[model samples]
Target: MTKFNKIVPDDFNVPMYVNGEFFILRPLSPVYSNLDYDAVIASKEILGDIFSDNWPEGINSREDNLRYILEDYQDFQDRIGFSYIILDDEESICIGCVYIFPSLYEGSDVAIYYWFNVKFAGTYLTVKIENFIRSWVVEFWGIKKPAYPGRDIPWSEWLTRPRKKFTD
Candidate 1:
């Protein structure tokens, strides 16, 4: 049996730059309400697909967005999950989000999900950020092999192997 423990930190530092000029990952909070909401609304189509079943209908509204942000903060505080806002360094714009949570997959203990603005899709920085998160999660959280549930390929086939150029 696998032993479960809280792997995420209580107070997360922000503006962690994984790909220097491309983007940075910062902890999400109520202070980011307007920016985050705008990003979500701008990327609604993409996020809808990623969060297919659970996508909120009222995500376009500031009130609903604030509630979601607050809930995310609470979840992070409660050690239930962690969420981060993705910001474009060049423009200082909120572009996307990353979420890590207890796995809902049958055999996995942890799961990771991320999304970026379509404009940033297929960029080298995307691959770098993905690799960085994978390594960071393993090293900082002590998770031997985190899983990307619902992905087209098995985690063992790609995640455990060396990083490669991301293909469509």
Candidate 2:
């Protein structure tokens, strides 16, 4: 299968950071382990629903969360995927995360997923982030079609859909 990086232009330069009215997006790293871990545990339930999977369940310590962020950093550095930790405007708190990568399901050029802390569960900030991501992927990555698996497609239906394949 063709990889996402293969489709990206050699000169493509993704944004190092993105700023929004309510939040900021920065690449995931171990530096924010304490803040990230606390946020994850605080919003584990909302995250479970957003991802439609059990995760962070096994994350019992800051070390566990650090490992997770390390993987995200590795994937990003390797150009396999991109994961960013969402932080409030002041940049002190970790509110959520966003993942952008090749689509696992058919009919989309890319897949994007995001979630906020439970406190922002139903706030306008959720709408702001969702809108920002939808447009950001298209403009930044030149994605013609972006799939929001959990938000746009029900997880059950999304899981049963055909997996995307790319040929060289």
Going through the candidates in order, what is the number of backbone clashes in each? 0, 0
Model 2, residue 60: C-alpha shift (Å): 1.5
Which consecutive 10 residues in model 1 have the weakest lDDT in total? 159-168
Candidate 1 residues 1-168, lDDT tens each? 332344455564423334544677777888778888777777777666665355756775999999988988876767767888777785367777788876544445577877776666567877777677777777766766576743544544534544323223
RMSD of each: 8.4, 2.3
- What's the residue-level lDDT of 127 in candidate 1? 78
Q: How displaced is residue 49 in candidate 1, in Å?
A: 1.8
**lDDT of all the models against the reference?**
0.67, 0.81
Pairs with steric clashes in candidate 1: none
Q: How far is candidate 2 from the true structure (C-alpha RMSD, Å)?
A: 2.3
- The runs of at least 3 residues in candidate 1 whose Cα sits more than 4 Å from the true structure, single-residue gaps closed, are 1-21, 54-56, 152-168
Encode model 2's per-residue lDDT on 1-168: one tens digit a residue: 455443366577866788887899999888778888988999987677788668768788999999988987887877667888889998898878888877877887777888787877778887888788888888877889888888888899989988766555
Q: Once model 1 is optimally superposed onto the true structure by TM-score, how far is the C-alpha of residue 161 displaced, in angstroms?
A: 24
Q: Model 2, stretches more than 4 Å misplaced?
A: 1-7, 166-168
